[model samples]
Structures are given as structure tokens and as C-alpha cells.
Target: MKRLGRRGFLRMVGAAGLGWLAAACGAPPVPSPSLGSPSTPQAPLEVASPPPPSAIPSPTPTRRPLGNANVPGMYVRYFQPFYPPTREEWRLEVSGLVERPRTFRFEEIRSEMPKVTREARLKCVECWSARRTWGGFTYEALA
Candidate 1:
């Protein structure tokens, strides 16, 4: 499978004394549903507790299930099952400090932009760490 670039990370960090809290990946970002601002306080992100050993699913044709793997395919670490958003529904919203906030569709980030492949880890305090070929595009490229 082809790789996709990372999008939306820490953007507005500078000498400006205003100090508006905004986060976009300084290098590559994995923009989720929402990253709230200070005006309306946001609850700390909540994640499910670690899954038991028995919870791990049997390997399918594509995945080995858990731990680091250099090959393609992904493992699900969540306790409950989930369906990731299809390309049509997923969006990356670039808001805050910028003069014009914009929403990027899947194609704009995955196809129109250049892609990069690198080894990276997904560390979570609530669960085990997983590694992958972190495919991401620079945040500045979107502009």
C-alpha cells in the first residue's frame, strides 16, 4: 500500500505575546475529531483502559496483531471494536491563529500532497506502544 503524509500539528508558536493555545504537529500531525481552544474548556482526552491478553484478536490475512512490525497492516489496541472513518467522512480542520481556517478532505492530504515514510512509535500511557512506518506530510505543505 502507498503511504500518506502526516497532517495538522503545533502551528502557532512564536514571539507573539498573545499566547493563544493551539496545537498542530510541528513536523507531522495526526489530526483527530477536534483539538479544542481555551475559550470553551475541553475535557482531557479519555481513553479506554488497556485490554487483557485474551482480548487480542487472532491474526488475520493482513495483520499479525500487536507489537512492532516493519511490514504493512495495522493492529487494533483499543478494548472495544471501532470503524475508522471512511475517506469521505474523515476531515482535517486547520483552525485557530490562522486568518482563514480550512478543512482538508482525505484526497487533499493523501493524494495531492507528497508522502513520506519513516519508522515512528505510537506511545500511549493507557496502553501498549505500537510502531509503524509513520507516513506523514509536513504541516506547512498544506498552506
Candidate 2:
């Protein structure tokens, strides 16, 4: 998939933030029909209405010790379960119907390639996203 440019990315982020703020502001609760007084003088059921969105206090923002590093949410939804391979045990294999096949260890790639640090947004298909500063080396850097 084609990546979005910084300007387009920032626009999306701003729009999302505005949308969150609008949602947080919330809609006015409609009064229930049963809330009206009965002409027959029936005993009124005291149904407790939930507090307004504004009444529910929001969590205050906290300061992070590590700059631009954001941890993933506590609850994660993944399509498939897979064991993560550690750098010490993992090797990248580059083999295909080609003239030469090559294999590189994780440590080799880390030591040999030029690394890049970038601020990126991790957006889920569910419309949830988080921005963080990521540091990694690209495959192109190996070339």
C-alpha cells in the first residue's frame, strides 16, 4: 500500500483528534417516556439514569519518562497468534527463483545497515491509532 505523506498524515491525526473531542462532549440524554406522571396515579418506578458524559471525569494526561515512546494498549486484538522470534534466534532468509540466495542474521543487519528514526502513527483497521517515534533500519539500507 502507498504510504501517506506527513501533511496528509497530520491532517488525518487532527481530524481524528477533533472527532474524539466531539464524541467526548457527547449527546444530550433524551428523557424516557415513563418519566412522565401518570393520570391514574400509579406508583412511579424510580429508574436510575446514568450520569451525563460530562459528569464522568476523564483521566488526566500523564508524563512519560521515555520521550516519544508509547507502549501498546493493555488489551490487544490480533487476527492470528504467532510466537515472536528474538533477534538472537532469528535469521532473515532471502531466497527465490533468482541467481543467488542470501541469508542475514538479525545482528548482522543491525550492525551493517544505517538506521532511521521516524515519528509514525500505528493505525488499526478498527479506527484506533497511536503515534510514536520508531527507530529501525530499512532493507534498502542493506543494498
Best by the TM-score measure: 2
TM-score of each: 0.40, 0.41
Per-candidate clashes come to: 8, 0
Q: What is the C-alpha lDDT of each candidate?
A: 0.67, 0.78
Candidate 1 Cα errors over 4 Å, as ranges: 1-75, 124-131
Residues 30-128 of candidate 1: C-alpha lDDT, one tens digit per residue: 666566633654787778899998999988678554454443455555688888999999999999888779999998787777887887877655444
* Model 2 lDDT per residue over 37-56, tens place: 57564787788999999999
Total clashes for model 1? 8
Best candidate according to lDDT: 2
